[model samples]
Target: MSAFDDNPFAESAGVNPFNDPAVTQVTNSTVESVDQYNPFPATNLASQTTPASSSPYQPAVLQPSSEPTPQATATAAQANLLRQQEELERKAAELDRREQELQGRSSTGKENNWPPLPKSFPIKPCFYQDFSEEIPTEYQRVCKMMYYLWMFNCVTLFLNMLACLAYFTTSSTYGVDFGLSILWLILFAPCSFLCWYRPVYKAFKTDSSFSFFFFFFVFFCQVVIFIIQAVGIPRWGNSGWIAAFSVIKLSKAVCAIMFIVAILFTICAVMSIILLKMVHGMYRRTGASFHKAQQEFSQGIFTNKTFQSAAAGAASSAAQGAFQANN
Candidate 1:
């Protein structure tokens, strides 16, 4: 009655995909002949009435398709990705190593270019250096010298006052002679104060020809004053309590000692001038013009003296005569 009742494997695909074989046919009479000689007997239906046919409704199992090929494709792609990543990492590592090598070579090249200083580097004249842009140290030195010079001058001045007092006391000089003495005091006191102060102040403010000019001018006056104070100026009442004062002046020895001190300070002042000239000459050789030369004359000395002397000499004949003529 049913189509499957005749053939059991009608809907199933054939064993081969390309070609199907003919189904084998078995007649009912042949089935009965095979059944008549069966060795096992069927169960009684009355005893199994509570259950349906024991055969499961599950479909027949199909042959498993080959799957190893797809799995191999996926595994191959995964392996290739990992290998590419490792190759990239290796290239990065190589690049890093090359960079380190280049850095090492660069440092080594620098050492080779500028060799290390020997343990015993000989001392050469410092005048032959390359000082392009700097403040001159001579300015500082001169300023300090000026300070000490002023202090020493002031000390002598104070001693001069004490000597004057002694002379007045010994000679009974009519109550300290404040008339002409006051005039001298008023004139010299203010003038000397400005001589040192004005120049030093200008030394800090301006770096021009006028500044140097004023400095030299005022300092020359101070030197002249020192000379006058040293040898002894007659009728100037500069004798103090020393030789020019009363014969029996108090503490004449002490006044003489003060005079010696004035001489020492004058020597120091002379030394300061000599050194100032040398520093100025050295500074001018660096191709600096008047303004710059004046500025750096005390501060920077970045050149060889021979060239400096030539350049400075060429600028001013008097300067050259003073500095190079000594050579």
Candidate 2:
């Protein structure tokens, strides 16, 4: 064998594949292309060489200077609790301030000449409800419900008038019923409002014994009126179920109207009964009594502006008469 053919690898080509010029050229080109695409040219490995210990990517383990003692932990908890306590105190103070504002408004209603209407408005707001908002939280809902009952009563009374007027086309006796209903509406509308509703409102507002007693007494009468109206006795202004069904054959339309009116009256009666029970339960808890009411009445009378003026005049006159008698 010849000297070149003595080695097996030298048979085809006497060159190493890894050390070939083409392979070295391709590797050098790939590295240059990667360097061209790098965004941070100044931070390239060729420009800056850093030791592994001083590298930018370092995994640091933070160690606290000292362990927390029990005293330190307790102090931290106490500080947090104190912050929470201060927050609660701030909230309670805000609530108290709001309560004081409400009570101040209640006491100064007469002083403020209440309803505080806007002077800019051309027309006055209806039915100046000065004391309505002063009702206690417990009774506010029930009081409004009672007012709705009154409205219902008024509507039913009006419908009863129409029904009775219609029934009059068949007979003359129903005319009396219609007239009485008109009178009943006229009297009860204002009287009931002044008697029970206003008193209950004021009772809750001022916690006045007189107002409580007055409400209980007048509302008792109101409850009786409701019962009587619901009964629909003959000659009564109310067109109750009995009276409506009794006159059904005469006029179906009138009967239907009367039936609706009767149902409303019945509902009013049932509601009145329920409300009376609830109100009485509340009143008993208020510690109101007849004696307390009398005292409040006397105090209220003595505090009246007219009564005070008359009392001053009487005292002045008595002093003058005594001076003349001494002279």
Candidate 3:
């Protein structure tokens, strides 16, 4: 009727395209699947509405470090000092051990051939050994003082030679003193170095009683020499008080020079005495004794090839002589 009112298909289907029963069933199934996987659930709405500061999301506050107190700083310094002291003691012990090993090697008659020298070389290179390095820390200062004294003595001796020369030029009578001064310088200089200085060095190095006693005996003689030199006896090589006054009548300039040398000699003597006392105290602490010295001397004597050879020769001669006499 209105366009033949409706076809038969149009009458069966709805006017809207979406009104198809198949499409409606598909839409309902898709919505049900989406609802099963909803990301923002409604139960968490209350937590999301709360302020961040009032919630568990607040940042942690940082605390500033406090300054150390005076007492704490002092304690730290003391601890550092103690650690340093311990390190020094450890180093000292290590050095002592090295010294002992070196001594042991020396006593065994073994030679160190490091950096081997050419056979054609005239002098053997023994420069690697330094006995001074082996001196103990407690005695190092005194040892250095002793070395300084030796140097002073050498200087004084040299100056005395000059003073004596000056006096000889002024007065022919003083020529003997000048000649003797030369001889004294020659003899005492090397002798003192070999006898007292080396022995003291070895004593401190090895705590050897023989070296200690040897040094003491030799240095005692040295002290006596200093006194005699200071006294400036006539015909003596030293330019002492007597020489200075005796030459004053000849030349005031020469007298002044001699007096100055004498003063230096006297100072050296006084210093030597003081240093000797100090060294003696240190020696006592080392427990060096005459008994130990005797033992060392005996050992040294037995080890000496010259002595052994001489003894063997003497014994053989005596045996031969006795056999001949018996025959």
Q: Give the per-residue lDDT of model 3 (tens digit) for 283-305.
A: 89888889999999997787555
Q: What is the lDDT of residue 19 in candidate 2?
A: 71
Candidate 3 structure lDDT: 0.83
Per-residue CA lDDT of model 1 for 1-327, tens digit only, reads 876576665555545443433323433234567447766558676885754456567567998877778889999999999999999779767755644543343433322111234536664221111112223554555555555565556665555555445445554552343233344445665565566544544443344444555666676776666665554443344433233433334556645644554455456457546645743563354343566645665533424345568878777888767887788
Between candidates 1 and 2, which one is better according to lDDT? Answer: 2
lDDT of each: 0.51, 0.77, 0.83
* Candidate 2 wrong stretches, greater than 4 Å: 1-133, 314-327
Ordered list by lDDT, greatest first: 3, 2, 1
Q: Pull out the clashing pairs in model 2.
A: none
Q: Which residues of candidate 3, in runs, are more than 4 Å off?
A: 1-132, 318-327
Candidate 1 error regions (>4 Å): 1-138, 172-186, 239-327
Query: Cα deviation of 169 in candidate 1 (Å)?
Result: 2.2
Best TM-score among the predictions, by candidate number: 3
